[model samples]
Target: MSRAWMSGRLFGAGVIGAAVVGAGLIVPGSALAATTCAAPPGAPAELTRVQDAEACGSTTDGTGGAWSLGAGGVGFADAVDGATVAAAGFDGGAGAGESRAGRLLAVGYGADSLALGMLDEPGIAVIVTGPASQAFVGDADDPVLCEGNLAAAFNLTAGSGCVLAGAFRYVTPSPL
Candidate 1:
């Protein structure tokens, strides 16, 4: 794939290109095929930790058709294990003729993890956004620490169609 196409795929814009390459639906050495992200040269190996949790809440908009928010979860990998964690929740309404009239729920790992320079690594930063009222199940093999570029994302839209849940895992370099 070309450098321009690769850049678009990394930022989540090249879905079709990625699908063609990922599913092996395209021929090898094709120019339009999707390309994966590569790590920067001379990047330092670091230790990482994965953290995950879930919560429940509700939202109000004074409309007759009230929307309920519950079962929220968040997961993310951190270079620094055992660091204090914080979470936030949000909700909004459609203006009038918006086709995408729905609610948005998001969770973010504070700047401490990103500030440590871990976020710069390939697949180190993770964000999952989807429909509201989703529940995520925890993985049985959860790791508290990992060595390498830990890639983690959560599907918050599961269970009861309105519950929110999250899971996080970290990757770091293994000790020699």
Candidate 2:
């Protein structure tokens, strides 16, 4: 699987498999859902919406756990492991530090997952807001992000409905 990622075979775990089908990106018919970015607990009320959408760049790295498009900080981590650390805190402390506000945005599934299996289950999660370069994961073809799919969870639309990409840090963890 790691080789596949290096060869550009997979993306955003599995939710994203975009290709230049013509001049447009190939978005899976059943994969995308509009999600809502509500104010997470402990977050100041002024931040009603904290983030926006962005495109993923070249696949510089690959772990392979595959993050649900809707998953948020520490939201999907509980699904894989019973524990989590905030990812938003790269201010100084990094790497498993509890101070950072982060979540499990992606995981290894192929060779990378196989490698991770030898020891601990490795997962990567980004924060709720940031520049596109740091906020997205995937090649430029399709950037997998947690915010783009928030409409459903918040019911931002009339009746689009929410799809469980993973868990919402602002809320509790729920399966998709």
Candidate 3:
């Protein structure tokens, strides 16, 4: 099966979440809830696309949490082809070691079907910026006979603040 993995890095303030679409298939809101975060009005949103399988396998370096993959939900795979196939943490807070005051959401996707294999699996990781971080994961209306995984991470900073992050992985049939 041919697998394609994509990672997105977003920096902001409020809630954080993710969504996945493959081969014209869409997972509804009921299935995958979006991550929410309070992004500054003029803060530049930096999105860097990581290509090359070798680069994806490299360690994700940052100031906050380290990178590691675990089993969650239905179709969660940690080490693929001897490489850690997963997304890294999102830096939201102001400075180094300075955590956010809200939730950080992450999402991952996986699949077994070849037609839908392009979507493959996604890895989600989150860091809380405030007092607490809450997470929710479910399937949308039109459900398919595929495996899915949903993982969440939250960091609670002092002073009535919350931070949240999550990820999703799903498996679908491939085109013959």
| Comparing 2 and 3 on TM-score, the stronger one | 3
TM per prediction: 0.18, 0.17, 0.18
lDDT of 2 by residue, 1-176 (tens): 48855443233322222111210221223223322222233322211122233111111012222122221211121122231322211111111111121223222111111000011233332222211111222221222333322211111111111222235423223324
Error of 1 at 56 (Å): 11
C-alpha displacement of 68 in model 1, angstroms? 20
What TM value does model 2 have?
0.17
Give per-residue CA lDDT, model 1, range 133-162, as digits (tens): 221212122211211221123211110111
Tens-place lDDT per residue, model 3, 1-176, is 22321121222122233222220132233223222222122322222223221111112112122122111111111222112222322211110111111122223322221111111122222321111222222122112222222222222111111212234332222224
Q: Residue 75's C-alpha lDDT in candidate 1?
A: 25
TM value for model 1: 0.18
Q: Name the regions of candidate 2 deviating beyond 4 angstroms.
A: 1-3, 8-86, 89-121, 130-176
